[model samples]
Structure formats: C-alpha cells, structure tokens
Target: MENERAVEPAGIRERLSGNEAVAIAIKQIHPDVFPAFPITPSTEIPQYFSSYVANGEVQTEFVPVESEHSAMSAAVGAQSAGARTMTATSSCGLALMWEELYIAASNRLPITLALVNRALSGPININCDHSDSMGARDAGWIQIYSENNQEAYDNFIQAVRIGEHKDVQLPVMVCQDGFITSHAVENIKLIEDSLVKDFVGEYTPENYLLNAKRPMSTGAYDVTSYYMEHKRQQAQAMKNAKRVALEVAKDFEKISGRSYGLFEEYKLDDADYAIVIINSAAGTAKDAIDKMRAEGKKVGLLKIRLFRPFPAEEIREALKNVKVLAVMDRCEGFNAYGGPLGAEVKGALYSLDNGPKVVNYIYGLGGRDVRVENVEEVFNELEKIDNSGELGEEYRYLSVRD
Candidate 1:
C-alpha cells in the first residue's frame, strides 16, 4: 500500500472559511462518532457537522456535551469502544481537555481534534496565537498545522490516516490560526465525496473494547513497574508518526493533485537568510520574502506543516547552509531562554558546529496583526546579523510596545 494511487478526481471548487472547510471534510469522512462542545472560532466546525447529521448527510452520532473536558472524555470512551471519533476546540477549551488528551494517546485511541489556535487567557483574549497547542506539545499527540483554509481542510482529511495507522495509533491535532484562517473566506478545491471516502478507507482497530471475542482493558492504572514502558511505547509511536505522515501525504497527492511535505522550503536552497515559521503567518512571510528578493536580498522561508515528532534532522538539513536564521514564534514560552519553536530549532542544530547563527522572535500574540512590513523587518535584522558577524539578543519580541 506504500505506493498506492487513486485516479485523480475532479475537485468541487467552492469559497469557504476554514471552519466550514473542516466541517465539510468531517461530513465527507463521516466518522462513527463526534463528541462536540462549542468554543468560539472552533464552534462552527461542530455546528456545521451537526447540520449534516440533522439533514441525513452523515450517520455520525453527534454527542453535544456541556464542556470541553467532557467532550474529550466522551471521545476517548467512544474511540476505545471501536468507533471512529473526533471533536473540535480552541484555547481554554483545549486546556480543559488536558487530562483526556493524555488518556486518548496513552490508550492508543486515534481521535482527531480540529483545533482553531487561539491565545491562552490571562487577560482573556479571543485571538490567534500558538500558545494553546504549544502548551500541549508533550501530550503524546501528533500535530499538523495549516497556513490557510485549503490546508486546514486537506490536513484534517489526511489526519485520519496518519493517526489511525497501525504503527502510529495516536490522536492528531489539525490546527489552524484562530479567526485569521478560521473566519477568513477563501477559494478552495475540495475532493469529490467518493474520492474522500475512498482515500480515508476505514477504521478497523485490532484490539477494541467493543469486540466481544477479544476482551481488552484500557486506561488502567499503571504502577512504577510498567508505567515507564507505556510512556516509552507512546514515544515510539510518535517517532513512527513522522514516517507515516509523509507516506499518507504521498497517497493524498495522487487523489487531490496537491503535494504536501513535513515542511515547505521557499527559495532556501541558495539563500543566505531565512525565517522559520508556522501556520497563517507563513503566508505573510512569503510576501515579505518576495519583496526582499526583488531588492536583490537572498531571503527565504521554511513553513512547518507537521509540527509534532518535530522534524528535527530534516529541519537541520534544510537550513544548515543559511548564514543567519530567525525562528518566529507566535506564543511566549516565558522560559527566559525562548519560545518552544526556538528551543526545538536550536537544540536540533546544536551538534552542528558551523550551523547558522539562529535567533528567536516572539510575535503575533493575542491576535496582533502580522504584516509584510513586520516580516520584512525581521529579514532586515537577519541581514544585519549576517554582516556584523555578531548575533545580538538571541531572544526578542516583535511588534511589542515597550
């Protein structure tokens, strides 16, 4: 099945917001269960999915719960019982599901979550940022991010196959920036229903609680004698996910005519300066790269698509030659060192004695606007660092008022 191909199918073109695209994808997959609780931005996903259930478009059991914690709890139970289950959430909603997040992964239940990325609250913000998802980076789930509505839809569709693969039975988070991509309308090409169904074939778990012949126990308390081994197995599953994700993307391209990779490198092959970023802001940075290129500056961008099982070796190879690099993080890690992304990139390149001089910039917190100009300024700073041969402040903030 590694080299499997499906006849390229004609796409149904439509203009839709990110939330609508994800919901429509869910309708097409038509999972056995969807345990839902509405949270702003992500609410539309379940809202649209519920309408599909109401109209007989899908036969999925739509369980509307009172809170996000219960939403995830129900998802874990349903998935363990041999049902294909999924749910949607944002910021605090995800925070509420904290415990179940680990439970689903530890139980090896491949539940999909449509996460509209929002800033975690202290001041109670309802805007775009990576804090929520970043905070759960170690929760033993696979994470894939999107730059726009099209990627959001495509990623969600592919997530099912990635998570449910026998070698990688872990939950998946299909994430998109809140309101930025989630609310903004854009033209997209959707796969035909038949093709989507054919691609995401079926969910047949080998060992499930529902199978009478094969009795099983899940979420049992593990003492010190066996707890570490269970954690180790989860880590190994995450490692397998990296290979599984790329294989799934290869097959997806056969049906959709769109190609995907662990990360996208824009003009980085012969570039001197580059920026590493994720999600919707990657679109803005592309524009900035173009502007800088026209002025005879060699600038490029690496946009991450598969965030979890963080493609460290691949990322190191991609940016090994660049003279200076900036890792743009939308969340504040407050580690006094740098954001999560910064820490990951630096750690990946630590073994390379001549690795690019890297710096981390925290930006776009609480839905603050990220424009081409701001991205260009970051590139300009990279150029200065390259020329000066001195990297100033390894950790910094972008567009924050002093």
Candidate 2:
C-alpha cells in the first residue's frame, strides 16, 4: 500500500551499517532498561551503548552478565517490573536464553530483542544459518525478519513500538542477516530522534488484575483444564499481533518514508511459477526472478517478513494465481523434514481449496554460498515438476553435487 500520509522527518540520515542503524533505533525509543551478554554480529550493538551509559548519552541499565541465559533473566525481571527491556544475541547465546524468552512472552512482557542471524555451532564454528531461528520458532515470541540494513533499523523501532502496544504485549525478535546485512554498510535513512520518539511514544505496561494489592500471580500454576485456556489466551494474543503488525507497519512506512508488509512481492502478479522464501536469501531470489523475467520466464518471488502468526491465509492468497510454488529453506531440521522453512511453506499452503503445486528446495546450509543462480536452478526444477502427480514430500536439494 502507498504510504500517502505525512512526510517523514528530515534527520533520517543517509548511511549506516545494519547494526549501527539498529543501535540508532534503540536510542530513539530510549529504552528504560537494556541488558545483554555480547554475541557476534549482535555483540557489537551492546558494546556501542557501553560508552553511552558511562557518559549518560542514554539513561539505561547496562547489565554485565556472565552468560546469555542470565542476560535474558535480567531482561525478564526488569520487564516484570514494568520497564521496557532490550537485549540481543545470536546462535548459542540465543539457545542459552530459550527458557526465559518463553516466560517473558507467556507473561505478556514487551521485551524486544534483536537477533543478528548467525549459524549455530554444532561441528564447532561461527557462521550463518536459520537453525537457531527455526529451533526457537515455537518459543511464543513474534519473529520478524529484515532483508537489508534499512529494514533492520526500521523493524527494530517497530518491534519496540508494537511489542509495547497495549493490545499486543508480546515479545518480538527482529532478525537481521549476520555479517551479510548486519555488518555490511548501507545507505540507510535514519528518522529523527524527535520524530521516532513521538512515533513510538512511551512504554506503558497494562495494569492487569494483578496490580498492587490485588496479589494475583503470573504464570500461575494451573491444572490440565485451565492450562488449555491459558494456551488459548496466548494463541489469541498472537492473532491480535497479526492485525497490529499490519497497522503498525503501515504507520511506520508513513513515519519513515519506507515501506514493508507481512511480505514483499516481486513480479508475482501474474507469474506462472514463484518461490516463497525468507531473510537475506529472498534478496538472492529476487535477483534471479528479475533475470528470469528478462529471459521471458513466468517466475516471481515472495519474501516473508512475518513468520510467526504464520500468515498462512495471506501466503496462500499471495500465491493463488501462480501455477507452482517453490519454497527455499536455508536451515536444515534433520529428520523432521527436508528443511525448516520448506516444512512451514508446505503446511501453509497444503489446505487451500486449489492451491498451486509446491516444491521445497534446501539450500545454503552451514552458510554454503547460494547465489542468484542457485535460486534459478530451484525455479527450473519447480517448473519441471509443475504438473507432476506428487504433492507433499516434494522437497529437494538444489545445488547438491553428486
């Protein structure tokens, strides 16, 4: 949708790295409490603010934690005390904080975190993959992705604004591509501090029945019968987040003069085939789609911005007109399915009355290079399987050499 509203403020500068932009956005909100244990790509952000704390550029508690687990615990405690909290980590650091992440969300705390995407170590090395994100997919926090430096900065602001919105007091994780986008310098436009402050306003924790003398407990112990209800409450809040995300995204575009939505479409309007993907990989697919269009191939691309709340209906609707859909997964999920995102893409479109035939392509595992040509290879395979009898269990590895 066109952001046909007020002009964005002028201080929105023209150049910064994705991490730097994220830092600036956090400063805009002036979080009441920001805490962290440094982890790469993401670690630099907390380091940037250390001097700010010492010189009082930002009035916030910069906690020194021995581990990422403790960092999240500190963030949760601060959040419960009605303070806006922020922290960031990647890979193992993210895994360490897994438990508290869920607790913060189930208790409806607006703790916004930045996940500078990095490959989780197993064979023991630091790199990039969606493994960490897919593992935490069910952690009850909203996961939003930024494909570039600007979106990283923009979404960081929106995450705080949306997470703290009264109707949607849910924890949000903003994922930015580790070194590719996070550390890469981009010509980013920074919205002014005053404008961002006005746009985000202030954090106001809702006064639930547990306030003051009421003495109600949060995450209170519950038997089987009541436990289901609490889960239902969480489900409903997730639903609320979908609507709020769209509303907030539209407003953000108006305020920053940049546009984004649940997804971005490139030549998908009337294409015969398309690929549905996420994160920085989508940028690769977009380039391939452009090349295909030039060669007269009817292929397009759909980049997912909001993965949680799945937006299944929206995804189906977006790909309805296409004849075949190819899903590219960047992270493997072992025996569960061919890859994590491929599994989700299948689930999202399987039930449609007459959806397009879909194919899953596993690519870029362990940070293996996946260029635009790799995406085209998958698109070619998808075209070959367009009218095949097979449907489910239809995933493949695009660039694997025998």
Candidate 3:
C-alpha cells in the first residue's frame, strides 16, 4: 500500500557503521530522553550520540547512567512521565536490564532499545552472537533483526513508529550483529531529518503517569483477580504489533525506497530446499543459495526480519510447499532440541498436514564465523535429507568444531 500523500523527500547517502547509523537515527528522531551506559560493541552508539548532545545537534536529555539496569530504569521512568525515550546496550548489559525490560513492556511504555547482539558470558567472550537479545525473547518487547548497517538504521527508525503506535504500545528491540554489522562500516542512505521527524511525528501519548489534565494509575500491583487479564492485554498488544510493524514498514518504504516485511524471501518461490535464519548470517546463506541455484539445485533462503510475535503465519505460508527446511539458530536454546529460532519454526509448521521435513542447526555461538562454505555444507545436508526421504538426526551443530 503506497502512501499517496507524498511529503517533501529528504535523505542523504553516507557511509556509517551500524552504531553510527543507530545514533544518527536517534539524532534524526530527536527523542526526548536517552539513558546511556557503555558496553562493548554497543558503546559506540551512545559514545557518538553523546557528541551530538554535547554539540547541541539534538535536544535529547542524555543521562549518563552508571549501569545498564539504571539505564533502562531511567528510560522507563522518563517514558512513564510521557517523554519519548531510548537507550543502547549489549551482552551482559542486556542481561542486567532483564527485570526492567519486563517493566517497560508490562507498563506499555514505548521505549526503543538499540541492542547490538553479542555473546553472553559464562566462558566470557566478547564478539558477535545472538545470545544477548535471544536471552530476553519472552520479555515482551517487539524484536526486529537487521542483516546490514542500512537495515539497522532503517529498523531503528521504524521501531519508534511501531512501538509508539496507538494499538501497539510496546517496547522495541532493534538488534544487529555485534562486530559484523555494528563495528563494520558500510555505505548507507539516510533519510532527511525533516522527513524522519515528519514520518515519526510527535509522541503525544493518550495516557501517561504525568499527564496533568487527567490522572491515572500505571504499573499498579494486581492481585490474582486482575493479573491474568493484565497479562492477556499485554499478549494482545504484542499480537497487535505484528500488523502495526508491517504497516509501518510499508509507510517507511514509501519514503525511504527500502521495503521491509516480516521476513525477506530470497529465491524461495521454486525452492525444494530452504534455510530459515536471521541477522548477518543470512547474507552468507544467500550467497550460498545463489551458488546452489546456479548449479540447478532448488535451494533458497528465508531471512527473518521481525522475530517477536514470531510472524508464524507468514513463515508457515513461505515454507509450506518446500520439500525440506533447515532452521539455523545462532544461539543455543538448550532445550535438548535446538536453538530458540529452530524450535519456533518447528512450532510454526507443526499443524500443516503435509509439512516439509524440518531440521535444526545451532551455530555461531561466542562469535564463531559462518562462512559461505559452511552454509553450502548445511545445504548439502538438506539435499541429502530431501533425497533420502528419511529424516536423519533432526538436531545438529553447523561449523562449530563438532
């Protein structure tokens, strides 16, 4: 659906890293408050944004919080007070904000979290992985992933609109691969500040704790009588977000010329075998898919863009006709099955009468690389499964020194 009411176009093409892109998006939005704490890979986000604050590029009140928990707490309080708010964090930093993450969502505060995906500590490694955001999968935020710097910028911009939508007032997590996209510089087209400001519009909330005209209670403790209903409302709002996300994406495309959806289907129309994955690894899988396609093999790729509220219907429709499907997960779910993504895909396809044989592979933990050859090897496994007509081990590790 094209937004036929065209506004004046404003954008500039420039090279920026993922962190830079997100900071620039925030600058363009000129949010009311930003509670910032420093963490690896993601620290650059606030580091750059702080400069903008110091230079008076934007009016955002930059709160230099001591920890990620405080950062999110500040965001929640500011947002509750009817201020547009945002923050950035990664890895253990995100883990620290776990409790507040639930608070921000449950209270229906439309705060935007820029999460640069990284490995969570146990063996303590600092690099790119999905362990951070994936760990908070059930925390009630609308999660979106980006495959490159440009998508990171675009997702952050759209997140503000999606989370702030009247029907879907939920927090949004815009995730990008840590070092892969966050630290790596790339050419990106940026929409004009006026265009972005017009696109995002003003954050005139309907009801807030600080709205002097009308007083209302928020985040009040609910006993058993109303707790379940509150939970139900939160769940319903999440369901509402799937539709709002697509609508915002469509509107975003009208101005940016960069289209987005629940997921990106690459060469999947006639594919006999396909892999469902997310984030930067999708690029590697796409390259592998091209090679397999050139060899006359019917292989394809489905890159998940909107993860939370899972997009199950779209995924089920996209993969229903394939002969075999492989779901690639970058973080381990440790459910004795596979990663969270693989498990979600299986659930998505479980009701289909003649569902394709689905397999799960957990790969790239602690920043392990998934090269094109590794993706080809996974495709080879898929082809073998399709040909054999007998499902082999359903859960396996890909390129992990196993």
Candidate 4:
C-alpha cells in the first residue's frame, strides 16, 4: 500500500505493441465491464485484460465472448445498466457487430472500442490496411486514426475521457493499422497507472434515459415527430464531441507531457505546398517533406488524426500559407470523386481564403506499400499544378500499376 503512494504517478518507459499500449491505457480508467472477442491484432488487447482480471489487478467483469455479435450485445447491456464498458474487434468481426455499433452510438452510450485496423477478406492477407475502418466510416462512432505505437497509446487514453464527457455521450473507435502498428513494438513512455487513474478519474453516466426508479423508457419506438429531432440531437452531440476531444487532450497533456489535437501539423508554417494524409502514410510523407526541405524546396505535411467530425477550422489554419496540397488516400472511393480523406479535405477548405490548390492522390490498395519515396512523386505532381497553373482533371496514382 505504501508503494502505491510512493509510485508518484510519473512517466515510465517500456516497449509496447499497439494492442498492449491500448490495454495499458484502458487499465488506467479501470473499466467496470468488458465483453470482448478475439480478432487478429485485436485479440491481444482483451487477452491482456483477461490476465489483468486473473491477476486481480483490475476489479471488473471480464466477459470472454464466443462471437463478435454477443460481445457487442454485452457492451450495450452493460452500458445500459450504467456500467463503464468496452470491447475490441476487426474487419468481419466489426461487420458482425455493425448493427450494434450504430445502436451504441444512437443510444448515446459512452463505450469505447479499439480497432486493430485490418483488411477485409476476398483476397486476404493477415497484414495492415484501412479497409476495415473505411468500410465502417459512417458507423456513427467518434472515429480517430493513429499513425504509430505512441499515438495508439495516447488516443486510447483520451478516448474514454472524450466519449464519456457530459456534453458528448457517444461511443468511440480508436483505429490503428492492423499488423503494421498493432503487431510492431515501439518504445512508449507511459504515465503511472495511478496518474492515469487520477487523470481519467471515473465514468458517471449522465442523462441516462433508462432507469427503474425514474420509470423512463430507453430506445423506445420513435414516430416521425420525434425521430428526426432525436437524430439531430445525436448529430449535435457528435459535433460537441470534437470540442470535448480538444479539452480532454489539453488536460491529458498537462499530466502526460505529450500533446495532440485535431491533427498533427509538420513544418507547414512557411511552406509553399503541403500534403494532407492520414494513418501511417503521414509518417511516410513526413520523411519526404524533410528530404525536400533539405533540398531547398518549400514543403510541409498535415496529418489528419480525427476523421469522423472533421476539423474544418484547424484544417484551414494548417494550410494557410501553402499554395498547393496533395491529399493522398489509401482506400479508393471507387467511381466517386475522391476517397474519404480527400473528400474531407476539400469539404474543410471550401470556406478558406487564399487556400492552396488541392489534388487527390489515391494509392496503396490491398496492403500495398506507401514507402517514403512515393511522397516525392506527390510533391512532383503538386509542382506540376504550381507551374502549369492548372489542377489535374483526374486523380493521380502514386507508385501503383496502371
């Protein structure tokens, strides 16, 4: 007991996988209920929790579910009963729970899930990609992507705070590349569990409509009169979630000494051109940007972390000095105009003044590589736009077969 107080809640270093990082981060909040299923890369998170429960480190109900659907069902039931709950899944596992994923959001349940990003089957490989996440893009959860192990750990810690915030009662999905991040090991300086316990504090379900004492109805059949307004209320909560995320991140920074907000801006202050990308590709682009700058070229990178409630204001500010931007996406929008990330960038820039010219580059499909060299090609394409003073009529493919 004296050791608990002597711990001092300080930062400690350890090598952790994306899955293990999430497990450690969630342990801080001490979830009361977990109904988890095993899915590739996602399996280790719950496995860690199982060990925690067995070791008597966390006094919580750990439910080892047989299937994804049942796992989600347990989460909904637990959250409805006013318990702090969580779960994890991937690809088809996520699809199996799709029906409940929406319900968790619409019911305003503050549950959190870690998605070890995976590639959906058809032509399958147990590797890394964003297909699983992009497929569930509109599932109504507050979706955020992480580039590396540090981000995976950091975002998972912040997710509970943001999702359970009084103004933003919504489910959250923290996404990281399947095998790329989920399986890789990296050095992470973790805050003491005691500090995180104090930082995240506790979960208190507010405005819960389900109660035996109050005799209130929960998830009742809504008629046209109330259905639209109820959905509007959900939308408002989602918007409020963005601001609450910033506040949670701000408070988390005070305790952990690591900072992150809407998106990560890299060397954009005086650049004439920029690249807007997400996930692990941003790490690739960062390398390219650094190389180009060393060659006396003006370039920067903007990495989008939060995709669900897109950060329009910060998006505009990050590119304020740039004259051109290349928005690269891993997944395609098929015949649509642009992929998810590209479309969001354009949506954010419509209101900006003197903004840079933006082009969409779709590449790295089906677990392909987005090596650092590919970003140089994107910058070359942006230069073509700069010199010719004409935006390309079609999307550019970076290092992909014709």
Among all candidates shown, the one with the greatest lDDT: 1
TM-score of each: 0.98, 0.93, 0.97, 0.93
Give the per-residue lDDT digits (tens) of candidate 4, residues 1-402. Answer: 455532233589999988899988877778999999898869999999889889998998999888999999899889988898988888878888988988888898989999987777757756666777887788788998999999988898898888888888889999988877888899988988888888777776755445556655566788998989989998998899889999999888887888888988899888888888878778888888889999998989888888877788888877877888988887777766877778878888878767788888887776688887788988877888899999966477778766
Q: Which digits, one per residue and each the tens of the lDDT, describe model 1 over residues 1-402?
A: 498765566799999999999999999999999999999879999999999999999999999999999999999999999999999999999999999998998999999999999999989999999999999999999999999999999999999999999999999999999999999999999999999999999899999998999998988889999999989899999999999999999999998999999999998998999999999999999999888899999999999999898999999999999999999999999989889999999998988879999999999999999999999999889999999999999999999999
* Cα-lDDT of candidate 2: 0.82
269-303: candidate 2 lDDT, tens digit per residue: 98999988888887888889889989999999899
Error of 1 at 178 (Å): 0.6
Weakest 10 consecutive residues, lDDT, candidate 1? 1-10
Off by over 4 Å in 4: 1-10, 207-211
What is the per-residue lDDT of model 3 for residues 334-386, given as tens digits with 9 covering 90 to 100? 88988999989999999999999999998898888889999999888888988
Off by over 4 Å in 3: 1-10
Worst 10 residues of 2 by lDDT: 207-216
* Ranked candidates, highest lDDT first: 1, 3, 4, 2
Q: How many times do residue backbones clash in model 3?
A: 2
Cα deviation in Å at residue 32, candidate 2?
1.0
Best by TM-score: 1
For every model shown, the clashing-pair count is 0, 4, 2, 0
Winner of 2 and 3 under TM-score: 3
